[model samples]
Target: MMMITTGRMLRCVSLVSMVIFAVLVNECSSQHTVWDPVHASIKNDIAQGVELNAWCKSKNTDFGHHRIAYGDEFVWTFKINFWNTTLYWCKMWWTDVDGKYTEGSYAIYKAERDWDECQNECHYSVRRDGIYQNNYASDVSDLVYPWPK
Candidate 1:
């Protein structure tokens, strides 16, 4: 006959509990953790008479070209890649008052760079002078890219 004393039973329980906890911790620390999607928006804050043309893309996605009117915005949502190297960039162009085309390319969402700065939502304001990123902490839009001549 096999017998288990109270102390022996308690030790078995403790060992089983420890193994379960270890498994849970391992799963939680794995690279397959569910990542929440991030939202990025670009608004045409240019002059009322002008329209902004933009084409945005990432390594895995292309948002296509779009013509945005004054005060309108283009928005996209995506999940950060498993390796955390996700990045999105845009090429933009618009006609100036002088009948010249101004163009530029800028990074919109870079996981490592924006993960802390954007806090899951990134906003950009485009103007004749430059493209600016909206800083939530200061309520200011800082220029990130300038219009190319």
Candidate 2:
């Protein structure tokens, strides 16, 4: 049987430690800072052009839009910076018959490392009877409704 030497054993340990260190560094660097744009679609059927606005609220930041026209189908995208596990709320609104903005619908998401848990696409429609529907999409799930009242 061959005898093991102390220097060789030490070198083997050093190599294993270095490999572990490299793997940790790679994992830390691979944590991505995602600036993802959420796609939104608004279908208007009130017989008039209505202003649309979409936004999201997070712990430290609120991001979204001001005033956009909802003609036929209003489509827009808003960007959000996702980094940690945070509760985010997204809301959309349109101008009513009295020219006042009303909260049409909203969605709440608990975002984790992957934003796939949250909604990546939002679809809203205003019926001729002044009713609205809120729909959202995700990778793991399909269209969901009535989120947390």
Candidate 3:
């Protein structure tokens, strides 16, 4: 009768809806996840890591965790060959949700230094611009210092 037909129609609709829902769930489960973009860090090396001068904000690589290895002074040391290592950069600062950079107190306000110029100071420079490795002695290379603006 009418009641039997109504019940069968309802069952058919329920089965169809369940099949659609299951398919949707399976499709979503098989989809891949997306990654966010890399950002830079703001930190510096003064004496220790006073405020923040140099920083690196990047996506962590699958093979290695990202790190900004540097110091305010020369207190921090490099584990690898100093020339191939990250020894000169530190972190900088950003303000609010909008990402405005607020220069921090830790920064020496000094310019970015060439490898040679830094070598002349209390620190070690990986690539000596003017100095040559012949056997023993070397000459003082003209230094050109670069600062962050």
Candidate 4:
């Protein structure tokens, strides 16, 4: 058996320790804001503080847990309910990064309801007063742009 040199062993330990330290630092330093803050801001910009509960949680997600996140786990599911009547699947969307605004996913069915009502229930609003800014996208058949492409 070959003898293990003290220096070699120390170097190995140091490398392992450094790796662990780096990992810990990364884990602690990785901070991500939930997509809600961005979405909420959009609604606020348009509606001036009007928002939906789901939207609010999405933008302000603590990722820390408590009432909304609850131990860093998401407590809410993404969905749209019109006065708890119709559950639409398609809606315009924007992101938290640079406020990149965009329409909803055409692949999904968007929920429908008045923007003011959605803001009232969820406590949110958009920048303008129209179908798109009304908390519900007007065009239900399409998400991004109208069809006929």
Q: Give the per-residue lDDT of model 2 (tens digit) for 37-135.
A: 566555555446656565656666676665545555656555554444655565766666677656644444444522543355645554434434343
A best-first ranking of the candidates according to their TM-score comes to 1, 2, 4, 3
With a 3 Å backbone cut-off (N, CA, C), the pairs that clash in candidate 1 are none
Against the true structure, candidate 4 has what lDDT?
Answer: 0.32
TM-score, cand. 4: 0.27
Q: What is the lDDT of residue 70 in candidate 4?
A: 12
Q: Tell me, what's the RMSD of every candidate?
A: 6.3, 8.4, 19.9, 15.9
How many clashes does each candidate structure show, in the order listed?
0, 0, 30, 29
Model 2 alpha-carbon miss at residue 50, Å: 3.3
lDDT values of the candidates? 0.84, 0.54, 0.31, 0.32
TM-score of each: 0.74, 0.37, 0.21, 0.27
Clashing pairs in 2: none
| Candidate 4 lDDT by residue in tens digits, 32-81 | 21221212222223222223122222222322312221112112344333
Q: Compose the digit string of candidate 1's lDDT tens values, residues 68-108.
A: 99999999988998888999989999986678888888887
Model 2 Cα displacement at 127 (Å)?
9.6
Q: Give candidate 1 misplaced runs (Cα > 4 Å).
A: 1-34
Candidate with better lDDT, 2 vs 4: 2
